[model samples]
Each structure stands twice: as C-alpha cells, then as structure tokens.
Target: MTLVIKPLRKAVLPVAGLGTRFLPATKAMPKEMLPVVDRPLIQYAIDEARAAGIEEFCLITGRGKDSLIDYFDVAFELETTLRERNKLDALEALGPTSIEAGALSAVRQQEPLGLGHAIWCARSFIGDDPFAILLPDDVVKSDVPCLKQLVDVYNQTGGNVLAVTEVPREHTNRYGILKTGEDDGRLVEVKGLVEKPKPEDAPSNLSIIGRYILTADVMPHLSKLERGAGGEVQLTDAMAKVIGHAPFHGLRYEGRRFDCGNKVGYLEAQIAFSIDRPDLGDAVRAFLKNYTG
Candidate 1:
C-alpha cells in the first residue's frame, strides 16, 4: 500500500506564554512581538512558515497578546503616510505584513497550561491535515529556514517530523531527548522520546527543539490532557505515545538557533541579526570592538 501524505497548508504558532523572563519590556508587550532586529520574533517564525508554502496560520495566544495578533493586520494609516511621502521602500516593506483575509486566525488559551494545551487550543482551526508548530522564542536563522527544512523532511517521511540538535549528555535534562533505531547524520529514525531525562538514563544526546511538523492523529493524545513534567500537559508526552504508530524522525537543521526568550539569548539574537544586516553590520562591529577593548 502506498502511504498517503496530505499537503501541509496550515501552521500553528504557540505564543501564549507570559514571557516572565523578559518582564517589564514583556509586561507591556507580548514576547512574540519583541523585536530581534527590526522584525518581531513571531514574524520571523511566520515568514519561515510562509516560505515553506503554508497558506494559513493559527496563533495560540493569551491575554496581553493582542499585539501579536495585530502585527499581521494592515496598517492603512501608516501605508497612507508612506504613500504620501513617496516612501516606496517603506511601502514595499509592508507588503509581507499583509496577511490575506481569512488566512490567519488567533485563538486564546484561557489558561496558562502547557505547550500541549496551547496547541490543543488551536485544534478547530487545524481540522484534519498535518500542521507545523513553531515556538517563537526559539529563533533559528538559516539560509533555508528551519521550518522549511522540516517540511521537506515531512514530505519524504509522512509521519511526524521535528527538528533536533545534539547537546551534551549532561545537558539532556534541558530538552526532550530521542532514542534511535536508525541514523544517518541529518535524519534519524526515532524509536523513543524521553522528556528531560537524567544524563545517565537518557538514551541519546540528540535533543528535540522548537520546530515540529506533527500529524493530525497526535491531537487525540493532546486531548487526553494528561499532565506530565512540570505538572503541565506536556507536548513531549503526547509525542511519545505517537512513536510506534508511524515513522517519527528527528531532523538536524542546517542553521544557527538562538533562544530569544531570555536576556542573554535575546541580546545574542540582536547582535547576530545586526551583524548580518548591511546597514548595521559595520557600525555594530565597530561598537563591539570598542566595548570589548
């Protein structure tokens, strides 16, 4: 029997966290709306998904997250001002911010449950097809976007696919670790998934990260609403149950990833992104040298 794989047209972005780590700044704005260079963290994730051919996007949001929802809306007044000023560059720059009517949806996660719960909140929008899940805090910079890399892997392996990067075994407690049945450098066949296991008990140092292309069947597991580590409905728990049913593989990305949710990580993303921008690179490098000296 030829395995059937449906086209992935929708993506889910779980942005409901309180972002307590970046408080004060985050207190007034959603962390997803936090600017990395010029574009907000969530926008980068959305752009990556759009580049992968996802036509519709669903954001799992929460209170104080109105800014994230509004980011995709058309700024008629701003556009008019730019038009009148003949700021062609600024006007064209706004083009990507225009999400087509009915193409984007934002659902509220009433409770601050867990990542799995936030994802489950968007179930109605997901329907039956497989969808991608991206965590905005984990900003991955790639020549070919990280999510796009995973989408290509999903096309080849119809089962659930997620991005993974190897970490030290001592640090396995920091991430969900994977057990393997087969391995080839970029793609590894997943035999098991353990959420933050102790170093001695962890099956492998290969750890699952933020990007995921999950099949619809995983919804039932999420529906169970079972609380796991951290006393929350963990996404890892749901994914663990999904292992034997079909092919599950961890894909190592060809890119650099930054954890933009914390202060140090956020600063790192700003510097990394700035150093790559033509307008800011030279000045930023000069400033860095003087500061270091």
Candidate 2:
C-alpha cells in the first residue's frame, strides 16, 4: 500500500506564554519579540517555516502578543520616509517582515495552559491537514532550516516527524525524552514519549526539541485536554496517545538549538549567531578575544 503524504504548508507558532523568565523586560514585550541580534526571535522561526515552503501561518497567541501580529503589518509611514530619503538598503531590509494579507492569522489562548493547550487553539486553523509547529523560544542555527530537515523526513515517512537532539542523560529531566524502537543514527523510530522524565527514569538521552511536523489526527487527542507533567496539558502526552496508531519517528537534525527561554542560553545564542554572520563575525570575534584576553 502506498502512503499519501499531504504537502506540509500550514505552520502554527504558539506564542502565548507570559515569559516570566525574562521578567520586567518581557513584562511588556512578548518573549518572541526579544531580539536575538538585530532581528527578533520570531523572525528566525518564520524564516525557517518559509524556507520549508509553508504557505499559511497561525500564531497561537495570548495577551501582550499584539506586537507580534503588528510586526508583520506594513509600516506605511516608515516605508514612505525610507523611500523619500532613498534609503534603499534600509527599505529592502524590511522586505521579509511583510506578510501577505490572509496568509497569516492568530488565535488567542486566554489562559496560561501548557504547550498542548496552546496547540489545541490552532485546530480551527489547522483543520484536517498536517502542519508544523515551531516554538520561537527555541532557535536553531543550521545549514538547512530545522523544520525543512523534518519536512524532508516527513515526505519520505508519510507520518509524524519530530526534531530530536541528544542531551546529557543527567539533564533529561529538562525535556521530553524519547523511548526508542529502531535507530540509524540520523532517524530513530519513536516507540514512546515521556515528558520531563527523571534522569533515572528516562528511556533515552535523545530529547524532543521545539520543532515538530505532526499529522492532524493528534488534535483529537489534545482535545481530550488531559493534563500531564507539571499539572499542565503536555504536548508529549497527547502525541504519546497516537504513537502505536500512526508512523511516529524522530529525526536527529543537524543544528545547534539554543534554549532562548533561559538567560544563559539566550546569551549563548546571541554570541553564536553573531559570530556566524559574515558582516558581524569578524568584529564580534575580535571583541570576544580582546574582552576575554
């Protein structure tokens, strides 16, 4: 039997968290809007989705996330000024920020539930099609966009494909660890999922990151709204319910994922990303060397 894979086009970004981690700063601004370098963290996620050929985007947002929606809107006054001043370079830099009308939409998650609840809010936008979920808080730097890497696997497997990375066994409690069935180094068969399992109880060191390509069927499980780990609706728990029923697998993607939700991780991302850029790399590297010296 041939498995038909629906073209993965729609993507959901759940940006509803209050970002209490970066309090005072994030007290007003959505964490997704926090700048990694010159551009906001959310821009990197959107760029990754677009690179993977996602056509429609749904931002599952909450309070104080209005800025996220406004970021993509046309700044007529700003653009007019740039054109009048012949600031072509400045105007061109803003090109990618524009989202075509109707191409983007947002839904509100009124409460601070868990990741599963935030995703469930996007069911209406997702309908019956497969979609990708990207967490802005997790930024990945790679030769190929992380989501595109998973999409490649999804095209071949015709099931759910999630991005996984190996973490220290002792730190397994920090993430959703995977139970394995088969492994080929790059792609591992997902036997089961355990959210934030204790190091001793963790089945494997491989942990699921923020990138995911899931089938529409998982939405039904999320609709059940059963709270799991942390007394919140965990997405891993919902995905677990559909494990044996569908072809679920994890892809060990090629990239460095920074946990922007953590202060140290956010600082690391800034340095790493800045040093990776052609224009900023040399200057940033020199500054680092001199500062440390």
Per-prediction TM-score: 0.98, 0.98
Model 2, 84-181: lDDT tens digits are 99999999989989999999999999987799999999999999999999999999999999999999999999889999999999999999999999
Worst 10 residues of 2 by lDDT: 238-247
lDDT of 1 by residue, 169-254 (tens): 89999889999878988899999988889999999999988999999889999998999888989899899898999879999999
Task: List residue ranges in candidate 2 displaced over 4 A.
Answer: none
Q: lDDT for every model?
A: 0.91, 0.94
* Prediction-by-prediction clash tally: 0, 0
lDDT of 2 at 106: 98
For model 2, state the Cα shift of residue 230 in Å: 1.0
